[model samples]
Target: MKEGRRVYGAEDDDPPGPQPGHEYVELVGGALDGQLLDVTSWAGEDREGGAMLITENGLHGPGGRADYEPRPGTPDKWDWQGDYP
Candidate 1:
C-alpha cells in the first residue's frame, strides 16, 4: 500500500477516493472512457482537494449531448467538466 492512499471497504483493490495529482482512466459506457482527477493549488493553506467522477464528452449549452451529465458529489457539491483530447 502506498502512503496517503485510501482503500475501499467493499473491495481491497479499489479506492474510496482518488489521490491528489494522480492520473487515472476508467471505462464508462459504450466506447467512451472517463478519467479520475485531482487538481492542486500551491497558494492554498494545505494540499488541494480531490474527486472521483466521469468526464463530460460534449460542450455545455447549445447543441449539447443529453446522455451524459455531471456527477453530483456529497450532498451539496458536484464534480463536472474537463478539457482533453
Candidate 2:
C-alpha cells in the first residue's frame, strides 16, 4: 500500500495507498491479462491506475510509454529503457 511498492496479485494484502509522487505497480492477470496498472487507490476491493499495456517493447500508457526489461535477480525491479513517464 505504500508508494512505489510492487504488488503481484489481487489476493495479496493491500498496502497503504499510493502517496503523492509515489508510483505503484499491480500485476494483473487471469481476467485482466497482459496488463500492469499504476495503483492509484486500493480501498477495499476498489483498485485503479493509469492502465498500461504490457508488450514486448514495454509498458505503454497514455501520453507516454517506456521500454522496460525485468531486472536480473530482482523480479520487482524493471530496467526502464528511456525516460520513465
Compare the candidates by TM-score and give the number of the best one. Answer: 2
What overall lDDT goes with each candidate model?
0.32, 0.39
In order, what is each prediction's RMSD in angstroms? 11.0, 12.4
TM-score of 2: 0.28
Point to the candidate with the largest lDDT.
2
Query: What are the per-residue Cα lDDT tens digits for candidate 2 across 31-56?
Result: 23333444444442333212333333
Q: Write the per-residue lDDT of candidate 1 for residues 1-85, one digit (tens) a residue.
A: 1344332221466555556465332223321333322323322222123232322444443333323223333311223334223
Error of 1 at 69 (Å): 21
Clashes of 2: 2
Off-target runs (Cα >4 Å) in candidate 1 are 1-15, 30-85
Q: Give the worst 10-residue stretch by lDDT in candidate 2.
A: 44-53
> How well does candidate 1 match the true structure in TM-score terms?
0.19
